[model samples]
Target: MLSRPDVAVVGAGPVGLGIAWRCAARGLRVVVHDPAPGSGASHVAAGMLAPVAEAYFGEHELTGLLTASAARWPAFAAELTAATGADIGYRTEGTLMVGLTADDLAEARRLWAYQQGLGLPVTPLRPSALRDREPALAPRVRGGALAATDHQVDPRRLVPALRTAAERAGATLLPTAVRRLSDVDARVTVVAAGCGAAALTGLPVRPVKGQVLRLRAPGGVPPGFRHVIRGYADGEHVYLVPREDGEVVVGATVEERTDTDVSAGAVLRLLRAAVDLLPELAEYDLVETLAGLRPGTPDNAPILGPLPDRPGVLLATGHHRHGIVLTPVTADLIADLVVTGTPDPLLAPFTPARFLPPNPAGPVGVTGPVGVAELAESADSAGIAGSAATGGSAATAGSASVVRSAAGVAPAVPAVGGRTGPGPSAPEEEHTWN
Candidate 1:
């Protein structure tokens, strides 16, 4: 048994570790629990910090959160590096959103327009201009846009750095699994357990299966391309993230399934899409192919703030694909909340109460692609006056999410479809910015 700490954080993924580090740095006694700290979706993620390319219709609140978090990444990366002396492979080469065909260009244009309307910087580029930036792009690539703010980091390195920083800051790490909230003895307990948050809190945080591939350059040489390439290739949306160490991260398929098996179809589709966008990838060594699950929520946004049913328990899960980019802000906000016992306004839009049964009397609870803000409207229509509508704003229609309710408690299942960018808006791009 471990000594009771001031704060106990469940799960040791990047988010949990970051929170632990922040809290410990604030002079609080912190302990993090997880058998495997860095073995979740954050390890499997490509780590594209793309709030601009990821901005889609009906996700204004999430977009705001993403942009705020992205802004914090620069300072966060620098502080972490200075503290741990670990190079997390953070890069600011920005991202290129391209289209391989005329039709693909048309679809991409729609998304870009939506992104631009939000005051995001998305500059349209001619094929010639794009090639000037990255000559390795397929010549047939019709056109593309540039989101200069969309950066990337190597998640594999980041997880370890966070763990080290947390430990250095006087936070204790326990190689134990927390199955229930009652098991932990702390003044405040945060559930940052990724997909496991569902089993612990009965909140809707599901496992969104994503398969990723890592490729090495020929003879260990660096990739020819400098920018992260996210595009619509013959209708298949794909992204390619390059690293300074001659490794290219190619990913992923968003499936509702929970299994981690990497299917042949997923590999072929990914490779085909990648090669279609950048023919040079065909020659690179196909190194690692693996699958992991991203924790998704009913509104496709993270679940923050205190649990309505459990006072001392706070939630910091259901980040889905934006885990890497959102980490800095998540850590800061959650740590501040822990220190002050006050929630930031940014957290108001995404709350666990959003998923609670609107009318516990009627089996009506939250599930599937519905925005937490919409819960307020649902409550109004049901004639049930409750806080399900509190601290939430309207998440416009055309939203993709995961939610489930059973016996007034829904085991966290990923809000599967609430992805943004590419492929007819709703269930947009699950593989874009993880």
Candidate 2:
């Protein structure tokens, strides 16, 4: 193993690479370890930087975090491209949520109301109006909502660009897997390993599987289908993200506790949903199918900041499906927490301790020997808690508390449908491409 650097980042996905990049940019000696860096979910993601479309039933706080990250993308992408000379394909074409049927229209209306309630910028469009904006959409489209702030990036290009940028910023990357936390002891260690974080000794992260399909436009299909399209069909959510090239990405199914395998049945369901939204997709060439696991927490919000008991350890995982969209802000928060000993106040709602109680049961993971009070005190002194809780904030002393009783010490398994699965096992080896 190499000597402990100023920072040791685990899991070289986008978030990990982002942290290493930011830290190295500040002249900190950083080392990133991952058996395969960009080959994880970052490789398989459709790369829609859409915080608004992915909003769920009651996640206003998470939405705030997402919007903040979306706002930061342009600068992040530009800086990385300037540093590495690689185009990450950042696009600001926005996104459209379409409804093909009456029920879908009603749901769209309800979602629009919810977004309005959250003070989001959304515009309701009738079927005719939607067609006017996107001429390629099927005329049968009933209605839609437009989120003009939504954007996207090309994940295939982004991950590699981040790796190159981080190296250019003077971060060392080790293309080897880290088996445990004891492998490094720095001022801080961040677990941004996506689904792999659960296998580390004391983390409370688990894998939630997602599958996606990629298609190439047939010859003569006019290129430039701007805006990511999310559709409501048969009571399920599906999306199609068009890239600068002819590739259109359609995805994904949220399956819990399954190994990564691209199912033909899943692909068919995706295709049907996409064609239903825009019939023209049927003319595209089916090019690829793939699957990857997202690191999901109990609340589906990321577990940010220092681990409850592990003073020197920090968590940047459990981003769930929004990992790609949230990477830049998450990385900035990680570096801020490590170098300055505090997180921005905006990140308060997502603290890992939010899932832990005032007094946790077992040994605190890799954070060392501090309790929550001490951790909060240190963070507060550093002014990390002053910023909007959008990036990092002090764990509230008593909100949505998760007290790990004797029963909470079991191995980490993904929280699915309000219940925990079988305990953790050896990290499963799986791969997919889209």
Candidate 3:
């Protein structure tokens, strides 16, 4: 085991790995804990860097964060690739939001007006222009908008690249579920485990279920499209994202539950809507179906910064559907807090303190690091069970591996300086949609 780490991260998803990478690059002793590294929401994300397309009317603050994060993706991807010598498949072809009917066009116009009000960089595209840009789109498409700055990266490749870069930067990767923060011997512990953080901190984070499909374009048939298509048909939002490889990702259904089942109805709805937008997709082979849980909060914004009453613990979950898009900025802001004990202004609106009740107790920091035995004893007294260091489980259906839910029993300990038990077992050997 390495020396006692200065910081401990509780999740191994892209956000957690990015934080670890940045901290380690700054010479901070860092350790990341995850039962299955790089196999959470990240594994199933379509990796669309679409801040402009994702902006909602009332989420101005969130839009700012998303746009800032989007701006950082290019440099972040480049640096990660340069450091790890791994291709992350960062695509800059942009995105097209098209409507298949008059009603859909009206809805698109409403959104375009909203974007215009926000002074976003969206260009109104006529039907001819839209077709010229992406001839694969259905001829019936009425109108659309082009978010030329929005791009994408393959999360399957991004996660692994982040892990490699962080490891190379001297961050120790511990494939163990972190059940409790007291178990870690570090000065600070970061709860970035998506919904799993709710278990440790009693935060308001919960899981929002989503399902998506992956399809393969026929070999040299109908040719592949260049731009990502977010089309509306029969009031359904279906997106077709093409990869450098001959694969197109179609998604997703947003349901509010923890059920990991990939329903036939969801598959049908997505495919029916996608095929209506681009007929060629119907000829594409059905490659995979996936379902994942996005960690959500009441406001659907991330809760960053240190916990109010808990000392030595920071919250970094509740990203909802924007986890992939927000990774770079989340990592940057979190590394800032971890390295300098001072929060950045960019994190002011998303601070954990915003969720605290009135008359909150003054700030507290865990006095000193506790030994593994003492930490385990405390956890036992608290009735939190420890998670074993076993290999990762197979992904539920086609989603990322079943995440360690916070609503379960037997909480795991965050091994800080050195792990007390056997090392984590290998990740579940399985096929990814890559």
Ranking by lDDT: 1, 3, 2
lDDT of 3: 0.75
- Model 1 TM-score on a 0 to 1 scale: 0.83
Q: Please, what are the lDDT tens digits per residue for candidate 1 over residues 246-344?
A: 999998799998999999999999999999999999999999999999999878999986665354567899999999998998888777665444455
Cα error, residue 391 of model 1, in Å, equals 26
Candidate 3 C-alpha lDDT tens digits along 1-434: 55556679889899989888876665566899887887778777898999998998899889999998899888888899999999998999899999999999899889878987998899999999998898888888888999999999999999999999999978898867665565566756788899887766777888899998999878734336888899789799998889877788899989898977899999999999999899888889998999998899999899877676454567788899898899988888676555444454566577676666633333332211122343333234433222211111111121111221111111122234333433223232221110
For model 3, what is the alpha-carbon lDDT of residue 27? Answer: 59
User: What are the Cα lDDT values of the candidates?
Assistant: 0.79, 0.72, 0.75
Q: Check candidate 1 and list the clashing pairs.
A: 198-412, 205-412, 205-413, 206-413, 206-414, 367-403, 368-403, 369-401, 400-418, 402-415
Candidate 2 structure quality by residue, lDDT tens digits, 1-434: 65436567887888999989886665556888887778888888999888888776789889989988888888888888888889888989789998888888898889888888888888888778887778888776788989998889988998899889889877888876776665555545777877777766345677788999988888735444777888887566798898767889898999896589888789888988888777888889998898988788888899877665454567788888898899888888666555444345666677666666554454432211122232233345544332322332222322212322212222111111211222223343343211
Alpha carbon deviation, residue 105, candidate 3 (Å): 1.0
- How far does residue 211 in candidate 1 sit from its true spot (Å)? 0.8
Cα deviation in Å at residue 65, candidate 1? Answer: 0.2
Candidate 3 stretches with Cα past 4 Å from truth are: 220-223, 360-434
Q: What pairs collide in candidate 3? A: 179-412, 387-412
